[model samples]
Target: MPTLSQQLLAKEAKYGASNYKPLDVMLCRGEGVWVWDLDGKRYLDCLSAYSAVNQGHCHPRILAALTEQASRLTLTSRAFHNDQLGLFYEELCTLTRSTRALPMNSGAEAVETALKVARKWAYQVKGVPADQAEIIVCDGNFHGRTLSVVSFSTDEPSRHGFGPFTSGFRIIPYGDADALEAAITRNTAAFLVEPIQGEAGVIIPPAGYLARARALCTEHDVLLILDEIQTGLGRTGALLAEEHEGIEADLTLIGKALSGGFYPVSAVLSHDAAMGVLKPGEHGSTFGGNPLACAVSRMALKVLVEEGMIENSARMGRRLQDGLAAIQTGVVREVRGRGLMIAIELDPAAGGARRFCEHLRDQGILCKETHTNTLRVTPPLVIDTDTVDWALDRFSRVLSAA
Candidate 1:
């Protein structure tokens, strides 16, 4: 008979869509920055569910809020007001320093909501003609998996066979303010970009790229939308990655850690000029701002600020980056990232990143490969220096062997 892991894999392959190529190991439980497989093998988590578990897995505070709220109330559609929504709004708006917020269920939904708000603002506020407003996006951006979001992606895999794609989006090379300025016109509405491009192999843009983008957007009268879903809420040391550059975006999209992975809670936050155009009955989600999500998110935000997790993330990230840089392995071509969002790009001529990832998994460190040959390391914010050193030990061995 097959073991539980094998059985689960077989069942999934037989019953579900084969859309993912996950690592062979199966995680049964998680805490902080560690996970245990079904066979009882423990590993340090380096990916943190694509930065969703920044507060750590199953955090006691977030869990407490989730359980308490689950017992009290869960869903109450937007038709009537829920007691928790106002508190949620206050906490998120205050934390992010935004004038208004529109809650949604996923990062993709939040991105979509931002797009709609920008379009509406372009028409009503910016005095752009209807259906003529254009949004500029970068080449190596990964906003979300939604149809509209994917349409602007430069990756062939993401765009192939998924079109006829959505229109009104102009693509430009990232880190080039000139491209962005050239792409903008009288009908330009917004420029959407990811701070670090997590899915694109933790690609950090040139220094001052964001400041230039912000300046260009302001000059062009275009909204600057920063997709911080994968890099927000202390993942990159600061509360949001945008803080690293000391620039503010016209619109911000946050999710993943907003609920500490307890539930799907995402929000589109913007200044009054951008968000005010959204009126009642224009958009909503059945479970977007429910009592349960609101209560849990409120607690999650509290823990993130009060616990000093962002400071910890910064310290640990520096230690991890320094340690990885010390590894003089021939296989490593480059080591780059900001805060906990790090990446090790292997020599392309050597092979795919999966081999190294598999070896790391066997040595009790769990991480994921991205963009063919880049190994992404994004552990939970709660991870300490000792845990990071332990994972680095295993990583050192694996990279040395490779």
Candidate 2:
């Protein structure tokens, strides 16, 4: 008889939608920054599930929390209060230094929650008339796969045919504070932005752009909402990426590494005036604050703060950036990143990014391509210097040939 893994693979091939063009490998187990495929091959994970596993996969602390909570109780539907939800809120609020939190199940949901909160605050607090509240977004931003999120996306594939979309969003060129100011209006309720555009090939705004954006939002009485789902929780060497700019947003969306990939856990965190607008039953999810996910997220937060992972991310991220920059390859156009979220934008005429990614996979480095020609290299924060050097050597070899 074929093994269970083989049977599962067959089933997936036969029934699943081919929406994802993943690397031709099936992983069965992961630890720290490495994953083992079904055939006993090991690969250094460079994507980290788009920074969702910055704490690394199956982290012992989070795994124990999940197991312990699963043994006790998994779900209570948010119809009744759970001990872990309050604890999760306390831990996250303490870590983020925010006053209120609205838990959700995914990054998109958290972003949607923030949008709703911002619009409500606009009408209820800022006195913008109903349906006139507009949100400003950036050109190369990626929030999530929700309708409202795609409504502001400048990416054609993410927006095409996904609408007739939601309204009340305006787009401006990223890093251009002048464009931001031009886009703002009295009816502008919020400025929704990703501090560093992650899926837009790890594009970092020009220095002082975030600070200027914060000033503009405050100046215009608009809420500054940062979608930090891909950049938060030490992925960019900070609990929140905005901290690097010494600016604070009125609302922040976080997910991904919030639960260390154990489960889908996201939250909309904000100050009292912004989040206070969310009255009871205005927004919620059945599994948003479930005990199991909350317990796991609590442990994940502890590991991020206490285990010195953020420092490691900063250190290793520099090593990675320097090493990739040092690679003498003509195909490499530029290396840009903050913390562990790095990207290598190749010359666009060099064929697509997928071929290079497939080559890296063959070299036992599991990385992925993004946009059209940028290769995003985000590994787990637990990676050590030796493994990084090894990965660099392999990357250098691959790019040299390309």
Task: Report, for every candidate in turn, its global Cα lDDT versus the true structure.
Answer: 0.91, 0.91
- Top of the candidates by TM-score: 1
Poorly placed runs, candidate 2 (over 4 Å): 1-10
What TM-score does model 2 achieve against the real structure?
A: 0.97
Lowest-sum lDDT 10-residue window in model 2: 18-27
* Residue 205 displacement (Å), model 1: 1.0
Cα misplacement distance, residue 232 of candidate 1 (Å) = 0.8
Residue-level error in angstroms, candidate 1, position 273: 1.0
Task: For residues 1-402, write the lDDT of model 1, one tens digit per residue.
Answer: 998889999999999997799998888899888899988889898888888888999999899989988998899898889999999999899999989888999999999999998899999998999899999999989988889988999888888898888999999998888888888999999999999899999999899999999999898899999999998999889999999899999999999999998889999989988888877888989999999999989998999999999999899999999899899799899999888999999999768898888898889988899889999999999998788888888889998887
- What digit string (tens of lDDT, one per residue) describes model 2 on residues 186-215? 999999999999988999999999999999
For model 1 the local lDDT of residue 326 reads 91
What does the lDDT come to for candidate 2? 0.91
TM-score of each: 0.99, 0.97
